[model samples]
Target chain A: MPRSVRVRLFATARLAVGRAVLPWPVPEHGLRARELVAALEQAYPRLAPTLRGSRFLRNDRYLRDLDETLRPGDEFAVHPPYGGG
Target chain B: MAVRLTRRPLTLAEAERRLRARPGGAVVVFAGRVRRDRRRGSSVVALEYEVDRVPALARLRALERAARRRFGASELVLWHRLGRVRVGEVAVVVGATCPHRVEAFDAARYLIDELKTTVPIWKEERGRPVRRPPRRRARPGVRSAGSGRAP
Candidate 1:
């Protein structure tokens, strides 16, 4: 099986991407979180705006900063600001 | 359960019941309902709520613990509806039971405030075009929100 990151989109991000999840390809050596996000924006221009105001998670845990590295098979989730009552 | 994220309508009655009244305990429940507000020149018919269940429930449980520690709450109910909530329908309920009224109210308030700011929940507005009389009327129907059911 090929190495890939599972990118989960929610709410506005889902709307922008037209899907809830994506198999984002990444090098086997892994890459910085920032690089992955930039690549996504380049691939899906409509997602750029939503990405600007979103929080990132890896394996259900929030990323402290974009410096964190994303390895193959990691689940990356994008959460926009909450609006629930 | 101290917290819930469900597709069914949330209710203060259920929340109060979950608290299980005590002889001297005071309960304070805050229920938030959907409103028929206007947006983009259209009337909002319903709000479509979505959630990232794993993180959302974790945060709710965390808030439950915080409420108990901060306000001396003996019991709590934090329930939120997922999916299409029609106008005037209850969308969320957060309540607490404490030995006194002050602590109960404070705990309830804190849960709601924290839940809104921290939970992985979001809502999108579904609108109905305002009828201008001359224009053809839309069919009297609405689609369910996402994969969740509508009431």
Candidate 2:
């Protein structure tokens, strides 16, 4: 109910974070994608490596770069390098 | 469908049927199957595949478009299976129909390679522990020849 970002993790990212989704609290004004990533890395050191190789998505849309801002209630997804055949 | 991600089995017949949608002189179909491999002394029995549905489907559609634009593919089928897939079972199939063989082959190859790196899908291996031979028991008679205490 409170202002928070729903962070989705998959594959190695999910393994590291031990969850498929995390409710990350953020400022009402929104947070820079870069800063949010930094905070996630700081919070879950094990997920740092995966974060470095992952692509970010906000509301199911790919983020061109980390410069994009993520607002409250947004769904942020972390996609690791794909291994599908 | 030109692009799809489903749990159902992928077959060449299905791919061929899809490729029949439009007329083309040449067709190329590629199927990838799970392999029975030993990992860390365990025999892999199956693979559990997972996918981020929306993104994965989006990428597949993008690949389909690229194939059509680059290779002039008249028909295409890109299908991948999710959930448990046993060794030797088809896991994915990508095919293309072009005016000639060269383009068909090239397009099929591109579709598969790009799908591997672009699609949001991953597979986890499931293995069965290796069985070890039973230890032989020594014969219980005659004080055991060479029992070191006092020969």
Best by DockQ: 1
True contacts kept of each: 0.88, 0.82
Off by over 4 Å in 1: B22-24, B133-151
Model number with the top TM-score? 2
Query: What TM value does model 2 have?
Result: 0.89
Error of 1 at B106 (Å): 1.3
Model 2 clashes, total count? 0
All candidates: DockQ: 0.82, 0.81
Two-chain complex of model 2, DockQ on C-alpha atoms against the true structure: 0.81
Against the reference, the lDDT scores of all candidates come to: 0.89, 0.90
Q: Taking the tens digit of each residue's C-alpha lDDT, what string does model 1 give over A1-85?
A: 5488899999999999899999988786787899999999999999999899999999999999999998888899999889998
User: TM-score of every model?
Assistant: 0.88, 0.89
RMSD of 1: 9.7
lDDT, residue B26, model 1: 91
